[model samples]
Target chain A: MDTQGTFRQTVEPALVRRLQRGELAAFETIYRRFERAAWTLALRLTGRADVAQEVLQDAMLKAFERARQFRGDAPFAAWLRKLVVNEALMQLRHDRLHVIELFDETHADDDAPAPWAHADSATLDRALNRLPDAARAVLWLYHVEGYTHLEIAEQFGRSTSFSKSQLARATKRLRELLAPQAEDTPCTIGSTTTA
Target chain B: MHDRLDHHRMTGDASLAAALRALPASTPARDAWPELASRIRRRRVVRKAVWFTLPAAFAAGMALTLAWPHLQRSTASPAPVRVAMQSSSHATPPAAPDIDALQASSQQWQAWVQTLDRDGAPLDGRQLTQAVALQDRIGLVDLQLSAARNPSTTVGLWQQRITLLQQLGLLHLQPYLVATQRPASHDHLISM
Candidate 1:
């Protein structure tokens, strides 16, 4: 669509260039486009909407401060997501109990509708939320943010073994959560799919 | 049996992954953008101004100090030196109604005021006055020493005055001293 093409052109190249020059207007534009994505990630990581709001502001401020260093080689969205994630983790450390409480609530409310009840992929969301911070971060970066395990380890200041172990643990836990849901869905008699 | 186990694992993992993908996307709250922008702008201005002025201020101070030898040897009459010292020393004292009452204020109390400022703690107006009086005392002595016939004593007085001036410079940057100078460190930023 023309709208999609226009957004790509007007948003990416010009936006990156303007941000590189420290233009507030350009930053506002980027914020408007990506604020929801950043906030969602923050909320998921921290659980509380208030903490998410703080993370959003803190992340954007950091992004603006370091905007000059951002090379346009990576998509701005991915870079922004990483910043949001880092800020959320930093906030978690500061508050200490914020993420832990969220994790506990998620696990305790197994009977309650999953947090991502509105999504077609609700089961996966529940599984990811139940993960430990380090593991959850790796999974989100890998699947959602589209980073390689090697890249995730480098960003996390951990070795590749740690990154892989986290991913393995996340996958194992996800499988356990998804098994019940999978069983509940009645198998169609005419379905050719083996599972 | 192996094939069945593989199917169960793969399908379950995929389902969980999809659910994870589906966690509701959140929109950023509206109020944060402007506040963050303001903070960034404030920090940038403070850092840049500090960098530029800190070096220049240090350089000018060192140049003046280095020129001390030449200026001292040039045996001008005491009249010109007296006039310069008087002009520089003309800073008005605190306009407290009870100047005499404050004159007897202990130097220890005044030093506490200075210490509070150095530690980035707030001081009361009375304490501020005491600190100012102490600074004035040092400055006056330095001016007098500059005009003195005794060279060794003059050097000692100037050194003491410089130390006081350095303290004032650091204090000027404190948040409480917003009405004064905005602290932007350049050369000896860490020391300041």
Candidate 2:
């Protein structure tokens, strides 16, 4: 995860090799290396440092306990990230309501034409905040973790269809919120990133 | 504008992830590493002692019981002669201070056992009973160990406790841990 300097060029590959050979030092190094990455993800998702700490610690301990099961087909970081996300979601579920609902019944927007959108960063942030917790979680998992809908569904304890619906709805809401700032050419469909 | 949206999502997500990753790591209530390793060593020692002394203890007790009848039949005429023979043949080595220490420790253990009977929680259900038994057995070993004065005995008891804890799935209780944010990955994509 932390592929900085010598870790990427030398330490990482060596550690992986040692891990494959079942060496203790390798395990220690790996723990130390990715500890920060794991902690960060947990903190952001949980929105509390204390909860994040708990989740991260739990994830690492589990990883070590199940280290033997690590089939190297996927990078260790990916597996570790999945574990962290699951932990974060579990914490969230415990803290709040299970199913989240988001709707604006007053404004159907069916008759109105889609407007240009180029909202300020603050406005976009608020729009993201306005999304339901479940949708926010899906967006983070997809846009951040880069997980597929099926993976998100599996990890987040929802159906794949639910995951797809959440993402589509989130993107749609974001577009509408930022519509006032749209450029003359307009924000291209399926080109949310390319200006 | 489109590029800006993409940038917004990317940076916003990263910053959020970065914030999330900053959470501190917590130490589990019970660290399984030292406990596990120590338990493994203790079990090995216990097994070794059990392997050696069990058969011998059984055989010695049986031999004494079988000879009891024969000794009773010869008791009248040769009682003093038999006593002298027994004294010579069965006399153990001189009492060592370690044995005395062991005895004292066993007495302490007896007190602890009495306390458990008096104050320890009643383990009602079957599983609970087994858990209690596992812990109690460990305590019993400590008691036996104080009187036994054999270092090996202590090791054996420790090992047995470890085995029980392992079987109970207590060792794997803390499976997950903490870490920092991971960079977003780009690989396979699925649409459903």
Candidate 3:
């Protein structure tokens, strides 16, 4: 189901061509190029630094080993990103990360709205971290990551309604989290600088 | 003020997504290149091993396919083996272990397991699957025990039943003891 495109959509045909030849240097070049992006995506989805590290390593290894299977219709970055996403999701399933985090339902909200536009980056980041892993994954996948509800439902092995519900609840939780400081901070929705 | 609030509200969802997209990207504290390189090398090694071994395995299978009928024809028919198999059901070992102790031990373990399970502690999927399998094995032994004609066979079946019960008991008991930090029993039934 995820075979469509779980990868980041960045095209470099020459690099991909070299990659299909199984060149070690090309593999390393791609890794260096997207290491931060892939790692960031994995970390946000998994919410654990150690798990994200493993996901990055495993995703890179998988991409390198299976490079010959690249069809070239999509960008090499997207295929690699798919591997990273799959690896991160596998870790979540293996550890049942969301089950442990779901024990506390006090922060869950089903009818809440997303007022995150007014929250500063630091406050929003903190609140995002505090959201349960599943809800956060749903929110990120649906909103920023350009994942379809159907795709997300397939990834999580749930109904599309499940994805919709999680996003709704996650937005509500974010609203509640930022409610106390909503009036204090003026936030920017612009691009972030490289860390 | 009302007009401004309405404008922000209309674009709230889009701005929220843009805000999410703009959240900072982070680099992990540790570099993963060494581990990744090692994994790549290890996988290549495995792939090479498979490539080397696969043809040899295929040749072996082909050779066996060619030789199997001749081997079968040349060898004498295994009438003795068939007879032995037929007679195995009624045969019993000479010295049967004590059925009383086995039955008693099995009962005790079963009682302990039942009591523990009745307390309503959660069992994860793996442990629960194992428990189900152990019970199935015990049921099989019970079936054999019922059909047994000889005391030796009955005693052997009872021994199997007790061993299975012990394993099933441990499946439930291990978690409880670990949770409670109680000392565990390392030895089998003491008397027998």
Candidate 4:
């Protein structure tokens, strides 16, 4: 991920043209550049290694086939990310796993500082996977991917309210998942709550 | 390029978002490239066949359609006009290449070379020098063709122009051909 910023500066519009003309070498260079980001996003969104790998492949193939449609209005990375998100969401829809039920986390604090701030990636990753597909997807798309509520709504074919609700529920659920316990388990990260 | 919404504005999700952003990029356990490459090759082959076959089939169908009435007329009545047409066609026997066809092909190749160059086709230093020399030669042929010249001399110059154009085009095309052949190793990607 640290390496991506330097490479991103080098992705000229000419490279996009080469990709539009179906140059495999151009595409290969691009794949090597963004492979990690694409794979990571795929894994986070789908919460399954196999599905994430397949999504990455399908997203890349779509990027190749639809290169002509890239009007250069957005950065190529953003366009590719959109493709990954679309494919992963489509996979969720197909699997019927992206249901957004209101998570009843009444015990979760609404005002307290986020206990998850210091939680390690592995801890957050495990907790994130426990979320309902829709809520988790909305949260990731909203907070991490930097998608707007309207954009998230459009992608999921839901209302902005639906996006807002899912994000709130997912956030509350994560707080509970990371809330303080009687003893710090081996995998337990720092807790923000006072005993 | 995303217009990042204010996660800070959204009820204390800032810490959560920061943590997510801090997560390291992940990679597959095994390289997923070989399978992707095989799929790309298959798609390329299918696309190439379609591109070739569509124009060919269209041309064949058009030729048949245009020839149908002529065929029926000749069979219905072998008129004197038919004999005259047959005699005239036979008179133009296959000793020389058609000048007009050669000129058309030369123009198309010249256009192709120019397009590739405009698209920044990768030609190394030596190849670039050769391309410039070839283009100069083709320009010289055009200048000579405009002078007082016999039919044979004009044909010869046009043929020379076409040959030069083909050389330049092939030079411009070499990088793409090499790429399509698929390198045995991608260690060079590190350099790229």
TM (B chain), model 2: 0.27
Model 2: lDDT of residue A188: 36
Docking quality band of candidate 3, CAPRI definitions:
incorrect
Top lDDT: which candidate number?
Answer: 4
Per-residue lDDT tens digits for candidate 1, residues B69-151, read: 55444323375665566468865232222222222222322343354454443545765675587688776975786586543
The candidate that wins on DockQ is 3
DockQ of each: 0.20, 0.05, 0.22, 0.17
Instruction: Give the per-residue lDDT digits (tens) of candidate 3, residues B142-191.
Output: 99988987555666676577667657655765554454341223111111
* Candidate 3 lDDT, A82-194, residue by residue in tens: 77777777777667655734333454432344556667776777778788888888888888778999988878777998887788677777787787766655453332322
Best-to-worst lDDT order: 4, 3, 1, 2
Question: Candidate 3 recovers what fraction of true contacts?
Answer: 0.59
Reference-based lDDT, each prediction: 0.57, 0.51, 0.67, 0.69
- Location of the lowest summed lDDT over 10 successive residues in candidate 4 chain A: A186-195
Model 2 interface DockQ: 0.05
Q: Write the per-residue lDDT of candidate 4 for residues A126-170, one digit (tens) a residue.
A: 778778888888899998888899988877777998888888888
Task: After superposing candidate 1 on the true structure, give the runs of residues whose Cα lies further than 4 Å from its correct spot.
Answer: A1-10, A48-51, A89-131, A171-195, B1-8, B64-149, B171-192
What lDDT tens digits, residue by residue, belong to model 2 across residues A1-195? 534311122335556667656565666676666655566566445645567666766666546545666666766666666677776777676675275676543432332333212433334444455566677677667765667898878666669988877776655665566565454333333312111
The digit string of per-residue lDDT tens for model 1 on A115-195 reads: 233333444444455566666766666666666878877665568976777766655555456555555642222211101
Checking candidate 3 for backbone clashes, the offending pairs are A7-A78, A7-A82, A8-A78
lDDT for position B172 in model 4: 70
